[model samples]
Target: MALTQQQRVELSSLVGDRRVDAVVAGRARMVLWRDEGRSAEEVAALAGVSRPTVNTWVRRYHDHGVPGLADRPRPGKPAEVPGSVRARILALTRMAPPAVTGLTHWSSRELANYLARHEETRVSHNFIADLWRQHGLAPHRSGTFKLSRDPAFADKVVDIVGLYLNPPDGAVVLCVDEKTQVQALDRTQPLLPIDFDRTEKRTHDYVRHGTTNLFAALNTATGTVTARCFPKRRGAEFLTFMKTIAAAYPGRELHVVVDNLSTHTTDEVKTWLADNPRIVFHFTPTGSSWLNMVEIWFGIITRQAIRRGTFTSVTRLTRAINDYVTAWNTDAKPFVWTATPSEILTKVRWVHTEVRKLLTNNDK
Candidate 1:
């Protein structure tokens, strides 16, 4: 085949370019080799392709130039469901199932059946599943959220986030909270130890030995926890825990973050705060105890130490907790808070707007 100087350069570039498809590059190589006086069989052997493939590409290049080396659209059947039908299917998936159907959410098979019966749209469950996967829709899954109705929600968020991101110098910021009613459960049977192919298993049923409450103070600067277990989660116990925390870090200003639990704001607690000139309490917004960093530590301890523990008695449970706390303090690192108050409030506002839109649509 005869070739222009530009075509020769393009084919040579395609053969040497790393980004070009291997098959395209091979085709380009065969055309180049054929132009360089190589026979069809030699080019086929060099390109690891049949002589027919080499001849086909050489013929295509002679007719159409370098673009002929690329792939062509293969013939296939058209789509069964139109765009309108797919849109309707997605819209219905977003809605709660009709009361008559007695379904909380729409399953793929249920959606397919519903569409066939009511909308006169025939689609297989597998097709519906594929459509959902392509669009990243999951009608079967639900997530939970709570909008804080606290009048001072913004102020509290700013205050807490400020403390997290920029604490006052010469003062210790402590996220204080109580993890109440931590059960000391004893399994009815011995825990089956894990093997090479088996997970560690325990009995479903357990004896309730007792329950204890943990009052924790997480130091935001150093991640050290001052924690104690109490028989009851009362104002007096909280006061005692506060005193212990004070004694732990003497002569330092303490800003303690706590939830708006009744026990946390009792008259006794108020009097103690008044007496302690160095300590101040900052209450998290209502229903927003997640702001307390100690809650993160609580989750860590629950998963690591308490959740699967065989505690025959409360003492054993408390001992296990203390042991874990000691081990944790030995090499403690602070949990870094990254989100700013503005970022959090912006997301919250977006959620609120979406919720309002949903409610308005439901009313219609």
Candidate 2:
């Protein structure tokens, strides 16, 4: 018999519930397998039950709903561990340890020890760990997020993202940035090159051979990059790169997306922009380097070339970067932006509200 939507949902819920008796849960899973059109043998193998057991549950579920899977009173002594004790353990696991416990979280041993002392219930540490796994709880991890505090965040995001989604017909939109202080270090010992089965190996120690700064412009539409290595990341170098980019895309309007780095908006850079009116610089929101697509390319080049490759001198490192960029542009696909401006703004507003609340609480 075909299961109703509600019956299927209830059966799945019963299977997911850790509090359910093992036999009842197994029966729920077996019925669900058959509902999915699996044969008796497949259900038996999947649920770790005999073919006869599968048939019994399937027939029971077909006759009655999920309630049919309930075990008839078994002729045996009652359970050793009471239901209240199990629930208490699960509840305590969900909460932080009592401040008196002097612990941030409950480890299996600590939880077991605490429960035995407070509730006078004797349960093993292994049992506590098993309960935690069943209920899908983990208190030993953390994650992070950052909110942009730039006053003009919204406007800057709109300007840069707009260029990505819709570019002027004849304009070259470039995501420009500098990867500064790239070190060129040579390993004291030569690296062992990769072979058929062995991985490439390099010594832990290395010789510092100085560093170089890379100024790059990634074509938003073409996925190609124009890059130059400079000894310093000065506004003069930025102006020189801007001139190169202008000459490369001769006569077309240039819209460059950049971060709010001090050097990017220096007097010399501003003067250069004034002279070249066609080249406009759009800065991404502060603390939001992710908005710049060039950073993505920077990550790719670092992982593939610079991270492990040995460079005896800055000259070698620069050549390696140029080589990788050349190879990348041959098949590079433009990074697509999917988050709409409204969606981004909504998230930013929520983050702003949270940050404000935190500051207000701190002041108190």
Query: What Cα-based lDDT does every candidate model obtain?
Result: 0.80, 0.76
Tell me model 2's lDDT, rounded to 2 decimals. 0.76
- For each candidate, give its TM-score against the true structure: 0.60, 0.56
* Candidate 2 lDDT over residue span 1-364, tens digit each: 8888998999888865545554577788788888899999987766556999999988988887777888666698845766666766765654557767886566667787887887688897667777777867554321111356689988887888788888888888999999989999887643211111122223355788999999999998888999999999888888888888899987789999988888889998888889889989898887677688888788777757986678999999999998988898889788777776777788667656654654565468
Question: Considering summed lDDT, which 10 consecutive residues are worst modelled in model 2?
Answer: 192-201
Pick by TM-score: which candidate is best?
1
lDDT of 1 by residue, 13-37 (tens): 8876534554677788889889999
Q: What are the RMSD figures for all models against the true structure?
A: 17.0, 15.8
Model 2: CA > 4 A from native: 1-145, 189-204, 355-364
Estimate the TM-score for candidate 1: 0.60
